[model samples]
Target: MRRRNLTLAALAAGGTLAMLPGAAAWSAEGSYPDKPLRLIVGFAPGGGADALTRIIAEGLSKQLGQQVIVENRPGADGVLAAQATSSAKPDGYTLLMGTNTAMVAAPTLRPTPPYDPFKAFTPISSAGQFSMFLVVPASLPAKSVNELLAMVAAKPGAYNSASSNSASELAMLQLLGERKVVNARYKGDMQAMTDLLGGQIHMMFTTGTLAPGFVKEGRIRALATLLPQRSALLPDVPTGGELGLGKLTITPWAGFFGPPGLPQAITDKLSQELQNTLKRPDVHAQLVQQGFEGYGMSPVKFAEFFRAQYEAFGATVRQHNVKFE
Candidate 1:
């Protein structure tokens, strides 16, 4: 869908990807990546994003003939990692496994934004997309989306919903509307899911990558998904549209990015290799098994897609009057 298109229409409208200063020197280099490269992840280890990044990093290492180290720097709903990557050298050695949370939501939600999503980094390529699952502890009385909302309604602000990212946070707000419920923030899905299983929280909007196992094991109950249709990973769970939440469509996605001024040659090489890596039968199979749809785009197209998603998210945040500290 729209995320897969990489916002082509946005690119078509106007604006070019801005390259930071001091990139020309590295752009001309013949041989690049003479050493190991660091791939920064914005979430803690064992989460969906971290798992996906590791999968891609393995394949990327094989493609580039160099080690693609996965580093975790989780904080501020992933702003810490994004900011770290943005300030790093533009030599392509340091890269970010960016998510909509850091790339779009953090900047859109915060009053004094930490960084500009587009200007802080160079778009490398689209990584993949997944849907969010509205999940609750298995022991909860609710079996469907309506039932869960009813429980929250019975005791306003009594039930708490966890959100690890801005997109998930927005999804929760869209569903609740004027309903009173506590919105608890966490650094990553794993942390939130832990509390969800312990009966500490009532509900959350989590990804297929992380929800399927818990749902299958009877640890959590998935009431609905944010996708327009049922997810293959959680076929039994109804979609937001199926539950009369058609407007609750939020596509959770991940992509690759380099620090500002990343050389064009290195960016192109990485993007092409990422595309090739995603197309690999083994890599593709793994990502799918984890509830992710693997895909990639050129740097130019990614730039356009980035702009589109950034603007779209910002507009959504404003329309909802969503705020974050």
Candidate 2:
């Protein structure tokens, strides 16, 4: 009886030992990025999203001690990248640099979007936020939001605002409808800016990264920003909210996301690395120079913030009756 008990005990002990390595392998959270990670940006190269992703990718590569490559898959107003990232394995190898337009506004704009915004992906962290500015050709006379409103009100449908068919355009349209201003629409902000410069379009609501350089060079005049407060880069410009157009507070934001069901260990590690990357002084300064505010948030906080933005954008879309083809 004693010999039989000893053999059974040995077998149980061996089984437990065999299970230990598998458990440790599953729970081994450190050195999170054991392989190359892909950071997907849903815009073409040389755009704001690409630029920011490149910066973050470099920093993340260093932090993870692995190659973090930025892959651009621009199409369908950022929907292609969203769908691809959403369907990818949730192993931390593939990550999406979530944007306001693709993740939040697209669902409301399209009758049937490719994926559900909230369920298709898990939030990592918000990298930054930036306010869109209402800018015109430097030669235009209107200087403030009120003045511009009056001008547009006086000549309804005479002025035009440009955007890239996402939240930017929808927000601007909602603001116009609220103020009862009629205007023309273009395919994208760049085209609108081209027309504005060529004396075809009158005005456009554009992102700071694209507007500041033109504003600085006297190519475009920044009339007002769509943020609650003035931008540090363009300190002289006032916010539309401050001018009693609080409804125009549309701040473009960017965040990190991965496929749903990512292990909490991998998610936590990625979030920590992202927060550290954003904390670098050079990164902060570069983002500020581009008229963006560094908006690093914890994963939980970012999820809440993203949800709020999604809901807000949806409301704006509904209010404006926006539809995309």
Candidate 3:
């Protein structure tokens, strides 16, 4: 009887041991992200992307009841962060704050991209969108698109429009190709803006966040915005859509992504938490203050949106014959 009892006890213990892994998996699913979450930004501190990520991270941390940290790994026009995120483990703890430049534009601009934008990462959600503005020196004669077009056409290669290597410049080049405008290219937006202010470059297509101060101080004049409607911050300026150039809409967008093959349960949890964070009033206000229009969509929806954007930008690149080193 003692021997029989010992055998039964051993069987019971073995059964419980067999179930431990399954039970732990269930527990992880139930409580999800009982650990810290890190969000990687491709730009350095003080930029628009950093500011927006910090605001979102705070709200997300509050929602998840876990510490959410924003890590800046700014380099390669956001490629560094994207590559890091791509190589990271497919765990919910690590996320990349993807920019249009790094995810969509860089693939086309680079001669040989390090990673495939679509294949390397899982799309989480879009944080927001902001329009790019056409800014020129205040002393320039042209006041509108038509006037600028006529001036450029009359002089042919006399006026130049500068832009950074990201989507902003690509969009500007596309619009110019569509309108047949001519000019030069610069290494980055800041350099282009410097030349624009110095009367060396005629104009530039830049984000509202970058151009607002100059526009406010009258150092540069904002001719048109590249969004569907006018911005609340700059109500007086007309959008490219309102000016019969709706195709010129080139809004800068930011979003969250994780390493590829992340578990579905983790992805769902992160998506729900992100949606909740974006809904916060304070988060919305902070994003707006940084010139970002708050927008959040489901992971599937965001994936569709991302693909559409890539195709649209790809078309623009092909039409304009844009190539970068």
RMSD of each: 11.0, 4.2, 4.1
> Per-candidate TM vs. native?
0.73, 0.85, 0.85
Model 1, span 1-325: residue lDDT tens: 9785778866654233224453443444456767899999998998777888999999999988899999999988789999899999898899999988888877877777899777889999999787689899998999888888887888997889999877888778878877888889997788999999999999999887789999889999999887656777888888777777766745687899999988778888899999999998889888878888778999999888788777767766777777676
Where model 1 places Cα greater than 4 Å from the true spot, the runs are 1-35, 44-47, 75-77, 137-160, 186-201, 217-219, 227-230, 238-246, 263-265, 288-291
Pitting candidate 1 against candidate 2, the one with the higher lDDT is 1
- What lDDT would each prediction earn against the true structure? 0.84, 0.79, 0.81
Where is the poorest 10-residue window by lDDT in model 3? 174-183
Cα error of candidate 1 at position 137, Å: 4.6
lDDT of 2 at 150: 83
In angstroms, the error of model 3 at 43 is 2.0
User: What is the lDDT ranking, best to worst?
Assistant: 1, 3, 2
lDDT tens digits, residues 181-247, model 3?
5556676567778888899878888776778888888989888887667777678889877788767
| lDDT score for residue 248 of model 3 | 66
